[model samples]
Target: MPSGRRGRATWLGVLGIGLIVALLAVAWLQVRQAALLRQAVEVADDDAVLLVYQAETEYLRLRDEWSRSSDPRRVLDAPALQLRYDIWVSRVGLLHNERIGNALATDTGFAETLQRIDRFIRRADAVFAAPDGPGPTRVALQELEPELMSLGAEIHGLSLRAAHRVGEQIAARNATVQSHNLVGIGLTVSLSALTLAFALLALRQMRQLDRRRAALEDLAEHLRSARRDAEAASEAKSAFLANMSHEIRTPFHGLLGMLSLLRDTGLNQQQVGYLRTAAESADHLLAILNDILDMSQLESGRMVLSPAPVELRALLRDVEALMRPQAHAKALALHIGTDPALPERVLCDATRVKQVLFNLLSNAIKFSDHGAIVLDVQARDNEAMAELVFVVSDQGIGIDEATLGTLFRRFAQGDSSRSRRHGGTGLGLEISRNLARLMGGDITVTSKPGEGSSFSFRMPLRPVQAVPAPRTLPGDAPPPPRPLRVLIAEDHVVNRQYMAALLERLGHDAVFATNGREAVEAMRAAEGKPFDIVLMDLHMPEMDGIAATRAIRALPDAAAATVPIVALTADAFTETRDRCLVAGMNDFLTKPVSPPKLAASLRRFFGSTGGADFAPEPAAPEPAAAGGESPPLVDTAAVALALQAMPRERLAAMVHSFLDQGPQLVQRLRAAVRDAQPLELRVNAHAARGAALNLGLAALAATAETLHEGASHLPAHEIARHVQRFADLLPATRAAAIAAGLPLPAGAAV
Candidate 1:
């Protein structure tokens, strides 16, 4: 038992023992007192003394009456004489009582006196038996009086003896009561002392408890203060990290951009090799920066996963595409396979999954010189949930058990020798494991010295139905057809120059704005000749990209208000992307934007035929009679092609954006039809048809096609009917696209 409880139990036992002893003392006192009281009651002297004294007094009275009866002077008073005799006999009978007799028995003369009195009374009863029987009653009375008078001395002696014996017994009882009182007082004092000691013990215990409680309160306060200090320190660190990331990446993007531009400068063979080596080093530095950022986000609990329905095979293919080149350079074999039970599509964060696989595969390739690296995927049943497991095995420098224990720890590498040979930030495995755990899974490794290592990553399996493949833009297969007028909003001069050079190389005109204010002013100044697109930088002075985009969206001119604005910032955070999109930007592109990435973003808005230069005067749409079949609700083939160019989420957003604009298109078509302006009607229908075709909304595109084909020759009522039909097809097309496994953006209305 705990010491405190044991001490309490000991105190309780002592108290119980004291209580029992006190109770026993009280009982003994009570018994002694009761015995004294009983002794007093038994030895009462009043009855014995009174009985003997009365007997003597009656003897005197009888003797006097007898003397009178014997004398001639009293006449013959027989009745009076008999009464006195009877009184004397009755008094004598009382003296014979057992209580009085026993009390006086200590005097040996008591019994004899009682017996004589009884004998004399019996003799007197004969005379008194018949009141009228004799005239010689005087003689009878005279005889009884002598005997009664003789017995008086004996009775008087018995009275004195009873008084003496009772006095002795009373004295003895008083002594016993006094002794019991003394013992009871001593017992009471002992019990009171014991009770006081118990009270003192209880008071001491209470004081000790109070001290413990105060100490605990102080400790708790210290813990709370420490926690607050730690939190403040952590916040400061996170702030420093974010600020440094921005400061570093802003220049880093320019460096990478210049490197990209340097490639086109017609260099000799040796210069080209030097350029390639510098670019590789730059890429390696960028990778380290990304690892640091990832680690910081993971530590601060800010890394969020964007899980969606991803095609399993496509994700694996993407990993293979990036890793195969590294493997070929090392002269090592790379094999990737999946179990037949694996689902075709599953719900997961494709980007994070690919990142983890990339890290594992890169490590394998880095360590091994010639042996094969295998990535095998399998499915397993874990109780009620299904699990997907990825195993990466490499014939590399295997780790020992001692090193394996610290393998996944932060900044821990395989060994000191290997760490020196192959330098790294040593955060890739840690970051990968953290991401796996965030997704409700974990990563584990098994290795033996001089043998290969196998690392396994497992996560929950959430299968989803297959979605239609995204349609590919013509830019994926061909170059741009025409140059676009591009607006650049940036604060840094180097970034602005890099963007200008990049756009010029893509055969496009470039306009520069130093900040958001200047960008908005540039849009307003364009007036009749608006720029084809706006490339917004988020962290510019005076006003940021979000505010500038919002301001430009509020423009009175329709062309300026509707121009596509893409965020081009160094901030790669998800919240930044969401803020840009919510502020009405068309798309988001992170820092260090490559030529191919920029080109792809442009192709998303303007197809291969190119910018607004070709949009205003579109070719007339063919009539429905040219094709007998009606258009389907959604074109799965076109959507499949788009998937090759961009992600499904990006395509879904575009579809939703186009649908949200349906009401505006319907209003414009109605106005054109009401005014009977074929030119206006054709322009609106052509724009809608182009947007619908790009997003694979076949039915809406077909309806717009009809309106465009009939705009000139058809009646106003026919154009109005086509416009109404176009309006009716919007809701159905959205539902068809969503049913085809393109999820709507978060928090979007159904």
Candidate 2:
């Protein structure tokens, strides 16, 4: 039973036992009172007055016998007279009993009267016992009669007093019995009252129990209804995000394509500038859309993680590479420390792990005013397994306990004021925590206001065997003698055209397929002359790349089925890539595809005998500027490589196109600053840097890199200065291009 019910039972049982015992005591008391009253009545009936009365009767009889003897004719037989005297004397002796004696103890004559009677009996007995103990004579009888008669009167008086005393005692006993009856009545009334009270208490307790049960039932119903509503809402939100993602991405591809194609069109620097700004804004929107898609996938439980052996030092380098620029921009120190005991290779989802670390480091840089952000990696040996812990501590404006509770919540920021200064989707921490939990780990934070916050991420450490050394690029190499035939499967017309131009420049034969269905048909038609590779787009009409890859694999032609298939799409989600891989694709790539990235993908599948590692290594740092004069703005090596790849006319066209677009890009930079769209500014700067690097526009790339580095935090004035530097670099870039023998548009400054 419940404790509450058990307690109630105990109290009720005790009360009932007490009532029974009280009743038993009352019964015993009544029995004792009856016994006492009976004893008192017996005592009242045992009065000495009765014996005194008997004695008086005997005395009267003796007196009559003496009178008869005195008459002589009545011839008193002396023996009979003596017998009557003796009988009277015997009756007098009986008066000496304790009851009679006590009744007259206070009367002085009571003892004297007893003595007088006894003396008379003795004298009469002496006379009657002469010779043969004859009866009392008339003279002796007269003397004894006087004494006996006087004693009779005294005895009668003593009996009257005894009767009065007995009457008082009986009266007192009767009063006691009346008091006992009153007490019994009171006890009965009290027991009735107590029983009634006990019943009322029990009824009240039952009523309370009923009320509590009803409340609990109502609460349960409310919870059930709330759960149903939450599930329905979650489903609705998932559907909405999916629909939005699909709807936005379709046209977004076209927008991206249009922006890329616009670069080749002839236009003034200002017009080119507008186009670059639009492209950057589009990229920012795409990034935000990607974040939302990820959140949706996570919420709907569709996100998948692929774990592999990852090197700790190499992964840290990757993180530092991405974070170093942001830290440099703020002049904030970024320190990464790892315990010596940390394993060189541990099993983890490298990409997801990097994503979480990047998010944490990014937030630290955003919030900290001047203090350092420290990332410490260590391994803890738990009984079951080792746990790898990553502690990211930042001396930022610390979060209060009140705000800490909501820190990892989606769309929640530490403080409302910070939200304006440091903008974000606020899904980073939530995503990180969820990912950590999915990997059999958790994320926790410790912080105090005005101090700093330390976020610790701990995941089970499953180590793997060391991997062999990674492949390195051959230094200053040329392209291979053989140029492979590549098939391009793309649904976007502009993208297809761009790919064709790029392939043509690279000295390769290009086969085109507008959709997955045609791409599959093209391979089938190739017959024995199979294509070297299939660059498949994930999203397409008439069969998506994943399905096409599956179809090709199912083909009976082993050569065709085994052809290298690299997924090409704008979708950056790991789940999308994983699905393609599961469908039997060889590789994945995100779009607005770059030459180096494309080359790397190709090198991964095909041997790189021609130009291994096409990316330019960062040049050695020159001495600090002499007389504060800026160094040369462009790197000639990339221009030389471009010339080697294609005609100078083609290289010139690309450079001129980039120069013409510089002014517009700078204008967009200014506008983003004015609108306080830091993320937009960052995207624009990043794109500018990438494109500049492609054409070897070194100074412009440097300026864009600076702008990108500071976009999220730089003051408006500082950002404006960077924007001006970009605008000034346009004419400088055109002159540099001309100095390096690259083409420029008509009426260009050079």
Candidate 3:
């Protein structure tokens, strides 16, 4: 062949190979899509059939209950049966909703199977609803009996066909994948050979055109320089984004804290309402910011789900409680009901579920104006598969059909007008839907022009069986019967009062220390016994929880050295929580402690309810008569030894520095407030946190933490509140410090 024809023929061969490869890929994609569709339909069918089974089981159960009932119970069984029957009807609708026939288009076997299941349901309903007068409904049930079996058999047959189809699709995909691999290998080898051939030809041409070499060299050099410049610019852009995020977060925290405090301030009714609305708006803003952070993390493939068994009813109730306030404000009737058939608990991500439910309910409230909102949970069935469905419906501004279609899409609001009115980042629904699907479920919406709209989120959840409680710790070995005397070291009056009440309720006597140093002193003065446990607050004046715990655990006496120390803090972040555990604290409790949590902690420390054996020994005999004197519940020498474990000079220095600077810091904070400079107010507040934290000034550090978190967006008065708090802290902290006999720096008055 002539050289031109040979070259043209080679190009044609390459083109043909490319076309064949593309066609195969398209076919493979179609097969994969078809397989997914079939699987979905099968799942839907299975769920429908499962609901039917549950209905049948319930019908039989109710009938049996009715047979055993005398009067009132029989009446109850009738209503229960009716409820299950109605649910069964709804489950049939779910199957029809799948539109499997239409979706498969030409999958006749699957279509017929769905039709059979529908017919079987009608027959089963007739037998299920028959009056109790019948001697034997066997004949009536027999009609359903064959159809039920056949329906199942047909479904099974369809499933097999679907499976076979999926297998074929898989084979096709494998073949296509193999073809692609072959094409790629062929292309690589062919291209390499062609390049080598071209190189040989180019060498000959270069030999003939050596005069042009300098131009090519200069072009190559410029290209390399441009590539390097582009890379550097890209890195700079990333750094800028990171810096911006960090900067925004720091000030945003301040804004949030101030807003929280403002919410606590006294205001007129209307002003209070407005403040609440503003706070909620701010909270929503913070959530959006957090979502962006989460999205970034998720995109980087760093998101991991820590799934656990969750009590679904409890989770749902919590969501309803949170939204009830919003509904009440709107004067809208909000009703929440659950399916009688839904398992009490399920294995899923509880937090994610709550987040999804919260988003849906919030939307329902936001869009509604007059009519009641109803959230109904039901056990939906399609054939044999069971799934839980959550429906949130409202009589508010309904979404148009056009917009409803894209309701769950990312960053999509119903329309521009709604987006403006609602003021959302439009990520709530998308995140909800993603989270739903992540948990083997999905979210969908249905709305009409003027009526109400309903959003239903459904997920496939595994049925949970209650596990029997453990009898005892292994081998029937009982825990030690030592009496537990707990020392509670907390500074906040309200918190201290609440903890004291909780401890007293648990049948344990508690000794209170207002600050860290007093707690240490109390332990040191005890003559006879050892305090079994020390519940230390992370932020306290004079000496804080972490240090106090370290001090106590380092004591020379074996009982004192080994006494369990639990940390109490307001921060629930992983880093903070982990630090307490690593610092030798046995456990941690977040602030606003509930009674149950408090009791649980006590139970963990002391076995069974007879009585705690640990006690703190009372100091010196001069204060009490011999008969009234209790045995020393703590060892003073051991307490002193623990305090000496850490470098005494360093601890003393930190204490002196905090006291020396306290007055000046307070003065600067007051000046900042007088100037009405929020930025300066927050700067002082941040400094206060570091200083107070070092000195174990719990109350001041918490106030500082709050101010630092809420500084950027808080109103002026909110900033003023923190500044006032800082001033108040100075006097109380000095008094507590002096009372504990800590040396104050010269001229620093207590």
Candidate 4:
């Protein structure tokens, strides 16, 4: 097409050049011809006729002079007469001038007259010759007189004829000039016409160019529109997926909870096995749902990472424990190895990292029927960054080359036929890869036909100075142990039943509210009843957990306002957790809750009073000295940990400071309860609780936690009783501090 355009342009150039050259050539020729005609007119209009007139007049004057001389009575001076004759003869000779010659050439009579004049001059010149040659005499003068006189008429006639011929020549030259002017005018008009045509063609070509430019702009606009349309569709798809995920998972969580409850119901062995399998299938389906939701979040750029310092070794240990059962179920060996060079704590989103690892390990286990799957961790350094590399290698039915290619692509499975046998949504790997990238890491796989596949996740590892101690395993430090009056606020029947069964097993009295509204009403109606905790389901119909919590806190009766509120929901989003916290809820729990987790929540609120299952091992009773001295109330180890959290002087100040303000805090709590301001009571109680805990005042801290928890729901009289108890303990706590050897401020006393 470009060549064709160039060819067209070349033709236009040739045609334009050719036309201009033709016009220029015509103009140049006309100018040259006109210049020639002008030159001819100038030549034809020369002074020949004027010269002829002068010569003829001189002839007449000579004849008159000679005729006068012919008077015999006059004393004719020969020399003087001869002088006049010679002058006349000179005039006659000038007839031979070029202009005169050309003028007379076309005049037959003018030439003859010029010849007659020349003869007369010749004859008369003999008398006017030099003294040595001749002298003018009377007879000679008389003879020449008649001839000179006759020649006068002839010369006059010749002059008249020359003037007429000059007029005709001037007329002819004017006609020739008119012809050249006409030719020049015609050539100029033709040139103007061609110029107008060329301009019109150029103008038309410019319009076409403008049209093409507009077309290109339109095409660009169309592409932008198409891109925008595609983006909108993608955004819509993301929204739909998020909504659908929430809807499906909410009920799905209830189903899982029901399954947990069903297991407790005594049943036949076959029924138990079927139920377990059904539960596992449901769990798998939920997992697939989660994977789909993750993919949607990632594809829409809605996923966010919250990174914190994580203990790498502990994280691997947790991974091993979780994967061991599945490995054992399949009779496969699972090995996890960590290099000594790895950092104790690295900055990462621990949950997401675990998730990616879990996905990879799960796939490894599922694909491998019997062989071992090994997870190895090590520190790797590149030019730009340091990384923690985790490699999960499996030996079993090896992945084929073709299957490995799409292993990480969304909705892609290795073998179509095996998808049913090993069901999955096929988005796990894709989600894992996206998550890795979000945290400045990547997941890659290498596999060969009939050989093992190795999947590696590498993340940029940032070391942290404050390495948190290894997390205390469950049972090593049991959950908060305590049973208490519990309020279950849930809308789903199955979920409510599950909570009932679980709460009954935990040896706690349980009351029910169908939704947030009923829950609030139940608390209000309790009328100082001892409801230890409120499990507020977030997705209730009448009012959500946040709103209900707010309403409860604002209740006029302080006892009914400051109840311990725990948000329960199926939402696993960070935003939802934040919403729960921001709404004045004391704790948050994701649904499909286990007995241990529920017990933990209860223990967190009721502490030692709740039960031993969740209670921290009681601080050993202070031992008496060797001499049977009084025992110290404070633990030295707990005090040392406190000192590490603050300077010794600050710790002492805080301990003394809390004792000094103890009375005032108690008074405020009482006043808040009397005034029905649960927020104020909760705040004061929370402050006291924190300070008391920090100072190792276990009894005071425990009392404050109760006040903080029950300020709204515990009766005003009961709250006052707790307050009086708190005041009485101050003196005892001071005595214990002195016994523990902690120095008191000056002027302070037990």
What are the per-residue Cα lDDT tens digits for candidate 4 across 619-731? 44664467674323454654554443335655565667668777777667755654456778776666565445445677776677678789768755467667777887888
Name the runs in model 4 displaced over 4 angstroms: 1-240, 252-291, 467-750
| Residue 575 lDDT, candidate 3, scale 0-100 | 77
**TM-score of each candidate structure, all chains considered together:** 0.29, 0.29, 0.29, 0.29
Off by over 4 Å in 3: 1-288, 297-302, 383-385, 469-750
**Candidate 1 lDDT by residue in tens digits, 400-470:** 98989899887788876776787776788998899899999999999987778999999999999876668
Give the alpha-carbon lDDT of every model: 0.75, 0.73, 0.62, 0.72
Write model 3 residue lDDT over 1-750, tens digit each, in one string.
999879858976776686566556655655665554454344333333344344344434433443433233333344343333444344344345454344344567756766766676565556554433342244453344444444445545554554454455456555656555555555556556555655765675667478568778988999999999999996787667666777777888898799888878888665775676576556655655655655755456565666888888777756764676577567565666666678877877766677788889888888877766788988888675778889998878788988887777777887678668868878789888877777778888888877878898998757789787678866787654444578988775444544564565456668889888888777776637668788888877678777776576555444565566778876678877645754556677765354444556666656453332333322323534655743232223322322332234433444556655666776676455434456776665665664454344656776777787787776444555665666666667666655554546566545
TM-score-best of 2 and 4: 2
Candidate 1, overall lDDT? 0.75
Strongest candidate by lDDT: 1
Candidate 2 vs candidate 4: which has greater lDDT? 2
lDDT of 2 by residue, 326-350 (tens): 7646756566767878888999988
Error of 3 at 475 (Å): 25
TM value for model 1: 0.29
The C-alpha RMSD in Å for every predicted model, in order, reads 48.2, 52.5, 33.1, 51.1
